[model samples]
Target: MKNLFHSYFESFKGLRKEIWLLSLITLINRAGTMVIPFLSLYLTKNRGFSLEEVGWILTFFGLGSVTGSWLGGKLTDKIGHYRTMVISLLLSSVFFILLQFPSSFWAICLGIYLVMTVADIFRPAVFVAISAYSKPENRTRSITLIRLAINLGFSAGPAIGGLIIATAGYSGLFWVDGITCFLAGILLLKLLHPKRAKTEMEDTFIQAKSAMSDKPYLLFILAMVLFGFIFIQYFSTMPLYYSEYHKLNEMQIGLLLGLNGLLIFLFEMPLIKFLESRRHTATGYLILGTFLTGISFLAINLSDWAGILVVGMLLVTIGEMIGFPFSNSFALNRSDGKKRGSYMALYSISFSISHIFGHNSGMQLINRFGYEFTWYLMLGFALLACLLLFILKKILLRENV
Candidate 1:
């Protein structure tokens, strides 16, 4: 038993100190992630916006994210990941604070777009920082650790945000979120320094135009986009589902969503560590994981009970555990070593694209058809993603062969 415990922790061994610090920064920032998780509820319940309006606002937010992701890639390669992350983090804090002042529908929509654009630019920088700090063997585990921190913080955010909302309301939530982002930025600025040598520094001058030309990478991005489209339903629609259909309160909704992060914290690291040496490839994990993610939502359609929601969320969390780290590894491997930021940014754009389509289409479906139909449609999409990923795996193998 002791040996097993030790072996489980062995996966964490030898990772750079910067990786751990990066994870800390992620934890602190995500713990204050109050706005996005509850944005629909805030708009509909607090501000009295229609569901369709909320969808449009979210779409606008996604549009900015897509733009930020593209620009972030260009800047990361031009300046450096450290400066890019610091700038994004600090500017994001400003945007989050600015977000609270807008009351009109158009103003709120515009606010959301600006906030997301500045905030999301840090994503690729975070990926690049992880790649820069870790050794090859430790790369996948390093990314997992960062994600683990994010989930841990997410678990705290909604649970605590529920309390704050009940006591102080949405304005308090905004202040807390903005404050945490600022704190994270300050900490990152003080701790993270660029460690690249002269050769690595010169390599940054190399253009990332090559990544745009890679057909296999482009295909993989498409598959990731589909997975993202299905996965984002959790954020974009699930809260509304729990509230509208299940008639759950804010506290209950928060706890239900918090369960996702808690399950990831408890199970993901140990499971991944145990499986790391089983000779599994990222492709296999992606295929199995994407399929399970599909089945998770389908399970939701089988029952209306809250316990069933937990079970479905558990499946989703497990699938995330298997898929996400591998996806990061795959993206890193497929890109030029010096231009990781550009490749990862392109990869990050997949989520932004999904956000643009998923929220708008999901709410439209719910408004027109109902929630169950939305779930069914997403299930079909997930299955299609699985087929594409399978094809991707075959192509990858053929290229290697």
Candidate 2:
């Protein structure tokens, strides 16, 4: 196992400077994201509110993130990723500090939405930077490793957030996230100093825009949006399942979340590479992953054991191990380097939109329809994505590939 680990990491032996910087940035960014998974719970359970009210607050987060993602893309197109990232970090930090004040439910919701929007600017811009810096040969592994870092950070963040929420209250999360945002900006600036493009080909903003509008890319984006629609359920609904249905406490729930992160952290690098090596079926991996997530959610109904819930989550993690990075890589790889930030921003909009719907409407789905039905709904979304991607690939082959 140790030998395999060494050999696996050897794949990244000499990546472009930008890939490493982006990995670090991804790590820092996710560390701050400790809030998202827990925010709904904190509001509903800790603050003496109901899930429906929490849903409304979470909806704002989704909407704000969507708006921010769209606008950030435009900003990246106009200014540059580095500047966009800087502005995003600065704005997110200001909002994080603002969170320290006690406010009404509506006010808190507004703050959540605001920070979610402003803070999220880094990802697309960083994607732009990574695409700008890497060559096609190393791109898949490069993106995969970036994901590796993201999960590694996320691995720690949720577990830590659970601890902090228990000991320090929601306010503590704000302070930590705020400080991380400011430092993340500084780390990004220091690590990924923007380049003036040694050649015209170095930056591809206009080319990216043109390419993004292409049939294959647009269809792929649609698939991703649906994929996001299903995936965000993990954040919004899965917790409610563990809490209300499983009868688990925060500490136990935190362990499951932590275990989810650990699997991604420990196994994702090898698992993604292993999948990639068997065939060049990025689309297929996505379908399989999404299918498994739906199946796994259904499987949760089979057992009430918290340990079994971990088993189900492991399945979900494996599914993500196959799918999410595959979709991200495909979208970013197809994008032109200079305009990668904008392209990813738009891609991110699909994700943000789903989160909005997932948190707000998803709670309603659970409330009105029940948890099992929502999982079934997520399954349908995944199956739809599979069919769409298969058809889209066929079209791409005939038309573009």
> What's each prediction's TM-score?
0.88, 0.85
Supply the TM-score for candidate 2: 0.85
Candidate 2 clash figure, as a count: 1
Candidate 2 deviant stretches above 4 angstroms:
33-52, 158-173, 196-202, 205-212, 243-252, 298-311, 337-339
**TM-score, cand. 1 vs. native:** 0.88
Q: Looking at model 1, report the run of 10 residues with the lowest lDDT sum.
A: 194-203
Residue-by-residue lDDT tens digits, candidate 1, 65-89: 9978877877778777788888898
Q: Against the unseen true structure, what C-alpha lDDT does each candidate score?
A: 0.83, 0.74
lDDT of 1 at 367: 94
Model 1: which residue pairs collide? none
Question: Candidate 2: deviation at residue 39, Å?
Answer: 3.5
Top-lDDT structure, candidate number: 1
